[model samples]
Target: MSAYKNLVPRFLRYVKVNTRSDEFSDTIPSSPREVAFLKDLAKELTQIGLSEVNYNPENGYVTALLPSNTTAVVPTIGFIAHVDTADFNAEGVNPQIHENYDGTSVIKLDPAGKYVLDPAEFPNLKNYQGHTLITTDGTTLLGADDKAGVAEIITAMEYLINHPDILHGDIKVGFGPDEEIGTGADHFDVQAFNADFAYTVDGGPLGQLEFETFNAAGAHVVIAGKNVHTSAAKGVMINAIQLGIDFQNALPQDQTPETTSGREGFYHLMRFEGTVEQTTLDYIIRDFKRDGLETRKAIMQQVADDLNHQYQNRIQLTLKDQYYNMVDIIKEHMSVVEIAEAAMQALNITPDETPVRGGTDGSKLSFMGLPTPNLFAGGENMHGRYEYVSTDTMEKATDVILKISELNVQQH
Candidate 1:
């Protein structure tokens, strides 16, 4: 079957499995539903004639191998995609298919007209004119973020198996869980994957080829205050909620996710909850440079330290490093990047080398010695309602995978 013909159904099937990951869970896969879906995917890989189909229960990764068909010892290539969806409502995802989308119409997502996908709000919708777009029902995310990548990888592998004339070296494919929570690749066995270089097909939009990502850290701040009755609030009441506001004001007001873009660093406050007695602030610090990330972390600590000094040590701050920029590792292996660029050129797709403002599995995998970069999977507005993927773009992504394999063999 053609790649486009196989892509839609395969993608639809994968997204409906409800593999949404949890950030708070302590399990290996974060959620049991992820394990169940991955187990089934493992069986499917074996049935598709892949070899060494092993599902590692310890890390919730399913890896399969397609043996080399040529005698020339070419470097092995690996394609990876995460099986888990973002922390969005992914239950009973009823995907809506818009065949031959008109460029300008406001497509209503629900029967009640409460949600709509308008070209005005998302100008990129015009690019998919006359193409098939897969979207959610406005109640949940479409989960196309990485599912499109998973489908494309599997479909491309099946194509290579069917076409024996396309000689290539051994190709490895891995699908892991809990990527949405940023811990899926923490336990990734790079030695077992055994690829000289790899690509995580988890980027947004078509033609996006990224290697640089934010150096990240998470910060937790707690403020403790003495609560008193309103009538006796003269000098005895130290409101923790007010202290929380003061702490936030100490950070760079202009440096935040909303005000920053491309190569800029920011302090993103992800969560805040508390009462008069105690307030906690959860923040994610991001920078493209390691030194910049450290500076951002230090700023948070300085803020807390200053507050604690004035309030008799009523504030506590904790910071933890999350991931680093993949470019630091991928730069040394520019040949791998050149290969992807050439593949896109051959397919007449313009290569967009935009630096990712956020990190991916590739960020951690590169540090793990995989030297992985990220490729596009045709998803747009990921991780929430109104997320969509173009079937035409997905077909192109599948073709890119095949082309990359062919080009690698030719180069070797």
Candidate 2:
């Protein structure tokens, strides 16, 4: 058997569980399906010999503790991953396995159409030739976004449990829900977790270590217009679709995901659907700083005002704050970042410290008093049908987890 056989099998099992989080749901886990999945995981944790395994259905936080074998004043560390998959279709995920890939396009079957993982579109595919790659069926995601992280953390813990000679301190495992729906940390119990510092194995793309994320918010615009017959209404008719277009036109043409990179922020229009009676526009504002994030939101307000002014305040705007950057909180304790970097270095992996363009649960948990930083989970093109991960990269990520545990003991 391969060295990381357990990791792959564990990931496969997790994908089979239907834990798709719902954005419209009102529960903590968002969907009732997550409750069943967490119970299974808790049972597995007990089977793996972790003490005090917990699965709280009300809050949807799964936790477990691994006691230190040799207590030498080791600082407690934590690793966390969300158990839920994205709202995107996750049914019948028949992952195609490519062993010893040869740097070529791999085809996947989908009901919509046949898709290919071409190296031309995905540049990172070139780095994994001659290694295994597990891809989706072109219809659904592989659930490797954070499930890979979950499997990796559990597999590493299992390794340490089997090897008792490896002296370590207290370690905590945190599993979240509704991550893809943006409420992963809504009920995270930082004080109860009790870790000096934690790392969320929820970062995307291998070798990624991010302490910064966009200050994000969601905006909803409701356009109300007078209903009138097209043939008889000349001056009384106000087309709601035009008002929605006017709202979008006020924003900068260049500031978008397609044009922005690095630290540049963007006001993204997610979706807009409506007709003359009424229209709805969905927008998200993102930036690295709170001021800028607010500014982008203010720009949206201006757009709404411009349209409302034209339509006698017919547009109703709703803006809701989501999450913020974890960088400021992490700076207070740089040791965690250094330890992660040292661990990566030990594995011959160079750490790529970059600001996350999107938010992770770690960012919210840090503000909640956990001081969590994100560690890469070896996945790419996440929450989409084209998602994939290099088998060698997954192994490297597991190695990094092991080294991090060892280094945490050594440094403390």
Candidate 3:
């Protein structure tokens, strides 16, 4: 477990590859640049002694299998991480490496934004006072989101290969592109992955094990109205801009992201732009319970119906289901969660089992019949320049991966 001495360098090199996923792209990986990065990763996996390492440049997915050292038969578990950085700027990612911190004000050079980790703004700084904190230089984001997770998982696998005496079972490694924009699992070959249960090592902070995520759907609302001269507008004109505002007001404010947390779902307004003649409002609806999720969709429809009744069917609502809660699939095989829980406990980290307010590749993987859960990558403030990860937590996350491999055999 102590072989993480050179892990940071490997991870930093990977992040510098510019594997950011783009939502605007039609390709599965979203970016062809990710394929070049996957090639290097495949080479590293082979260098570290992972078996069956395969690099598919066309779709940009890298997979490798770590053979079991001990004769103990355990459930073949998979570890997954994403390679792409978020759509945020990756130019000049001057990652600040604070070897040992005194919990003082860590500043970005020429800091201009209101996005710093000040004690006054973030009281959580007190927690990592004495440890190492790696942050972006207030310019580009440090790709600690899932890159940290990918590095930790691979680092842990290397440790297992280096130490044969530490009994463990077979482990599979999966690294995909385009997770940031939600297409990481779109082209994944789960049957080829060949793991009964898996975990996405892509959660925030440490000891965070999530098997439940939001049942998500994107709602697009459109309104049609007639434009007329202002003097004659009273009788001939219909205003879609006002109708759009009314539609937003119709939803409960308390059910939004700012007011909701945990299993409590919310309606996230992704975009709201309109005009007097035509308006468009895009929203993302999320909830854990299937019935509650359906109820929310019904409420949205009801609002649209009422508006249409008033405006002579002028408003149209269209929804597309993004993803579903993976709980139903993951719960059927509860031992996978227990396996991760016991593994983290074995490594002396108190596991915090929480529902993800957001979705992950794990959400899609579980529905794909892999029954994947998520593990922490020891990061906070993801997808922004304020992103950072603790060296201690990253190392522990690696240990958790190793211990999970060991615990799988103990269960056998």
Candidates 2 and 3: which is better by lDDT?
A: 2
Candidate 2 stretches greater than 4 Å from native: 106-113
Compared with the true structure, what per-residue lDDT tens digits does model 2 show for residues 1-412? Answer: 4566689989888886778999888878788888888888898899989988998766788899999887688889899999888868887777877888888764444555568787788888887878888888888888898899999899888988988988788899988888888887888888888888899998877689889898899999999878788897899999898878888888898998889999999989889999898999988888999999889888888877877777799999999999998887888978889999998988888899988899899889888888888999888889878998776787778888888888888876
lDDT of 3 by residue, 171-259 (tens): 89999898887767878899999998899999987689998888988899999989998998877799899899999999988999999
The models' CA-based lDDT, in order, is 0.93, 0.86, 0.85
Best by TM-score: 1
Collision count for each candidate, in order: 0, 0, 1
TM-score against truth, every candidate: 0.98, 0.97, 0.93
Q: C-alpha displacement of 325 in model 3, angstroms? A: 2.1
Candidate 1's residue-wise lDDT over 212-302, tens digit each? 9999999989989899999999889999999999999999999999999989999998888999999999999999999999999988999
For model 3, the stretches where C-alpha displacement exceeds 4 angstroms are 57-59, 104-106, 109-115, 228-232
Query: What's the lDDT of the predicted structure labeled candidate 3?
Result: 0.85
